[model samples]
Target: METANSTHTGSHAIKRQGPQQSHNHPLRKDFFDSLSYWLDSPSLAYSSWLSEQKLKDSTKTVYMAMFGRFCQWLNEQGRRLDQLEADDIRRFLDSANPNLPQSRKARTNSGRQRQQYVRQLEKVFAHLSSLGHSGTNPGRIAGYERIGTGSDKPTRFLNREETQRVIQLIQTELDELRQEEKSTDEWLKYRDIAMIGVMIGGGLKVSHIRRLTLNCMDMVEERIDLSQPGHAHRARLLAFAVPAVKAWLSVQEQMHGRKLEPTQKIFEADRSSGFGRNSKTVTLSASSIHRRTQRFLAMAGITGERASAQTLRNTYAGLLIDGGATDDHLVDYLGLQASVTAQRLRNAYARSQLRPAGGAHLSKDH
Candidate 1:
């Protein structure tokens, strides 16, 4: 029979390489391509370089692809990337066409994708600046006016019933999966169940769970800390700790069975389905998170109130409020941003609601 030894060497062992395994590596087919790297000036936006510090690769691929196309357009116009002035960059921003071509056009991502592309161009210039390769970053040609997303729809989130249903649905799924004896390391049902459990239960951002390399989780200490990307005072820790923990012991067991190293994916994306375009997906991106939660909401048969993952988080906070937990306690327990939760005011308001169920604040009769 034919073997690796027959094909290239004297050995007959098979390597683990496959279509899925080698798909998501960062260095690319056209690593030296004219797009991501400008021969004269690569990434130059100060912010884009900083963005690279936390930029998701899926988004980067879009950015790089667009940049390549843009550079080619520039070349056709007898211009080079390094030589573009702020005015040149301004022209590109003004040249927006909703029906922009896609691979030449990748699948066109609307809404947030367009916003991020603007950010990426900004960062490209930042990276170039850091390398002393470009003169000025032009991503901020326009002020902070919102990009035209063709809609003013409210951000969707879960309401009271859907939240309850998600909890019940997960519980049901876990119980059924464990009983079926179908939960081998290969099957991965219980693991999936536990993951959904803690995420929905504690209002944990699923992105936080999925981004976990082994280093991001601290099982012995019983805490999970995922930092949101930003240099501002508002950046969140997303810490789930003792006394009121977000993750459970059950989830830890699942993590172990999944063969997840501290540095490996704790929560993975279902890349096999349309849920992902690439394989390095361990969990949903910070962007797709809202959509996934909506999927969960749909499964729970709970559809009212603009259900979203963040809505689940709000429900968690609401439960705390209903359960008489202080807002300060809720903030710390849920790792909320200060701006997002007004601990002092919300608690005072909650406390006032506890005032003897009366319409009048003052009593005329003792």
Candidate 2:
């Protein structure tokens, strides 16, 4: 029996494996036989179609896994791939059995997972239609309302006061580190302060922050050049300077015992990661940056699920829009691919601008 990982072959006669026997009792043999045939042949066509569309390998892998799972489920229902109707697809998504394992049950019940399954199956069926193997793509039926995950929430950003408080917290930490006499502590804190400044002041995504090198900044001009190759947005200038960032540069130069070179990563990891004068460049991972951001947010008494590097970015966007920058200007400034995202930020900014009555009275008396 050909396993899911079996090599692709042009032959239609290849034997395909069924679901594990322990779980196969519910499925009809004929359904498995049909599924095996489709998996061995039409699935190849689906793969080819995916490649033709220039999808990444990771996307292809995800879709293939989704197809395999769908086939297994279809066999359990005594249905062939070609026999599926829009109602059948909808029913499969709607029905959730408690007898299944926790993980499988969760996957089945998840609206997001169901949506992904529907999307992938749509592509697969479209490929089958293109090959004249199927006449209809059940996945595309109108009025087939997808299960709403209800997980999405509004993005959060710091207001001007909260933003200033966070900066003060970071500045205090940096000042403490400076007196510690430990070079490592000072260097690391400086890096942290610099990272926060770049995110809040420049509105750079985590990827952009990770790729920044020493040369990206122009101290004389008080602007950072983000026009590096492979950047998502066209190269643009962010016209703000964070004093903490410059302070970090000075500390970095002193720590290195020499002037830093332009080609080196701006936020390189510490010595524990083998970052040294003669070593190749190494930047902090996105996850690491996120964890650090959360930690700092907590330290600043800004407690919320949305206090993240992304929130800082949102804060930057909010500030820009509040300052009367248009959506087009924001798209260019943030290196966004579309004005829709900028528009969303603008809307969020507008909402944030609606202050409650007596909001100033709630502040601590100085």
Candidate 3:
């Protein structure tokens, strides 16, 4: 058996704590398939650590989802796991708090959530260290102890009035656009409307929109099939988004000057250089999509730190909860990696219902 501090030199270097199987484990089983789908390339070190953990399946699922989010955050910060230190872990925890960058006195206590995250990372680093993958355990008790706990905050989402205002703004614009003859501007507007509708009505992420293909939609059934690898939800009803998407598709067909291929991306750069089979036109970059979504919100008079595509998605979750969706159904509909987000949105929706019109409060939680 490999000792705690023992380092391995070859494939056999990283041994399991319990019985060692004759066949080597593939980096990990498909237990973390969603993580693999979200990541450009899943980390072998992460796989190894998760494979050896003794947690229950439910707990493991949550940790896997949390890790996926952490990896995405690290990418946004332009940091790599191998180069991370305890400070980076701390920064990540702080950033995860939506109420942050404000005075400490104004911040809601999220110590318990932070502590749990630290524990998960600690185990990850410990296992990765034994496998000779990491030099430090940034997720150690020091990080955990430094965090302060608070009651769970409800998720931030638009109320009914705000939701209506946004929808009305978009609809008015679409109606105006329809009055004019077809033009490049018209096509772009249609695309944006479809994007906003999918986000606010269908609850898709910005990343999902960036990678969506034409085949993902089923207009006949008013559903979207995101059943491909990495997505937790196989399909979701489009509900109110069907008309917007259909209109956009019609516009796109005219703009592209041909029958759209199922394999082609649904959204692409406005000034794509080409559109042939060998064309190099690509989907809007993540940043571009985010900025456009922000612009749309701004046009609708929705401006704030929360006036982004994610808020639109959160609003969709709130709508579902208000429409009598169970927490489990909300989780599945949104393809959330964990049920925590669904629960938070549910609570937020409930809180919104309880408040009087003039007594509304905004949430710092995202």
Candidate 4:
């Protein structure tokens, strides 16, 4: 083991040291060493492991920051990496000081952030064990019993009236766009309408929407194939016979001036030169879809709830359940891997069915 110097800080003192020399010279051992003076060996080892995995630079940066914070916390606790226990990990997440910096407090407050922290720690411990430096993974134990309740935000879904109003709004916008001369804006408007139709009509996830290609749609069959590589659930077909969907596709074909190739992305990024200008095809991001959906929802006067892609998906599920789809049928239609998820959806559907009764029953009887 190589040692450099030690500096005593307030509660946590960082012991600076050089990483063990490796056969791979270009691994940037010093860069990882600088991430934290404490646990330099493990951090450096993890960096090398990450490099071997060929992660992107942004991903590497996030992992490095997460690991550094964990190492700093461990140093404050006076515990070695191998000395960690499930309780120790749990306490670290549960105990938050009000006196801490705003950023630190915010990070601890977020359930999502804590979940990400546990995942990062798990990766580091897994790597350490692989290198024969550790035998146990406390992070995994902590994750199994993770702290914090799941999201409390109410699930948002469009009702019959709201759904019809949104459909009318999209039609109105498309009609206005069609009247204008052919332009990039006109093409993008059609794309947005098409994207919305697929999301609400097909109940597709944002990831599924982004992965859709021209070949995925079967106009003759009036269905869209959603069989993407590496999806958790089995690939299933979705009906796309809705008039909005047909109109969107028709406008898209007109915009391109020809039939799109099988490999071309169905929903693509807007460019100044219009659709299919350059050889490179850029797909719309999830965030882009979300922003556009929010705008459309506002136009339709929908407020006080999330009106994004997921809401549309939930709306689809609600509509199906109302239409007498069984749990097993829902599992297949929604491409859910487990029946338990369908059960949960069923519970949500039951909750949505409850309504206030009229006061006629409470009236005095003669």
Estimate, for each residue in 113-210, the C-alpha lDDT of model 4 and write its tens digit. Answer: 67777787777766554444423455664554343223223445676678777778867876676667444446677777777777676677665566
Give me the displacement of residue 245 in model 2, in angstroms.
0.8
Greater TM-score among 3 and 4 belongs to: 3
Q: Number of the top candidate by lDDT?
A: 3
Query: What is each predicted model's overall lDDT from 0 to 1?
Result: 0.44, 0.59, 0.61, 0.58
User: How would you encode candidate 1's per-residue C-alpha lDDT over 1-366 as one tens digit per residue?
Assistant: 111111222111111111122233455344332233454444332223444356687766666666655665566557655545333443344344434554233333355655565566666655444444423344432212122232222222344455567767776665565566443343344444444554545546443454454454444534344433221111121222221122233444353454544445555555356522444344544445444555666787754444445445554555656656554455454654453343543444344344443221221100
What is the full ranking by TM-score, best candidate first?
Answer: 3, 4, 2, 1
Highest-scoring model, TM-score: 3
Q: Which regions of candidate 4 fall more than 4 Å away from where they truly are?
A: 1-150, 175-185, 228-241, 273-280, 355-366
Model 1 lDDT, residue 359, Cα: 21
Candidate 4 local Cα displacement, residue 274, angstroms: 8.3
> How well does candidate 3 match the true structure in TM-score terms?
0.57
Worst 10-residue lDDT window, candidate 2: 357-366
Candidate 2: RMSD to truth: 17.5
Question: For each candidate, what TM-score against the reference?
Answer: 0.44, 0.55, 0.57, 0.56
Evaluation by TM-score, superior candidate among 1 and 2: 2
- Model 2, C-alpha of 183: deviation from truth (Å): 5.9
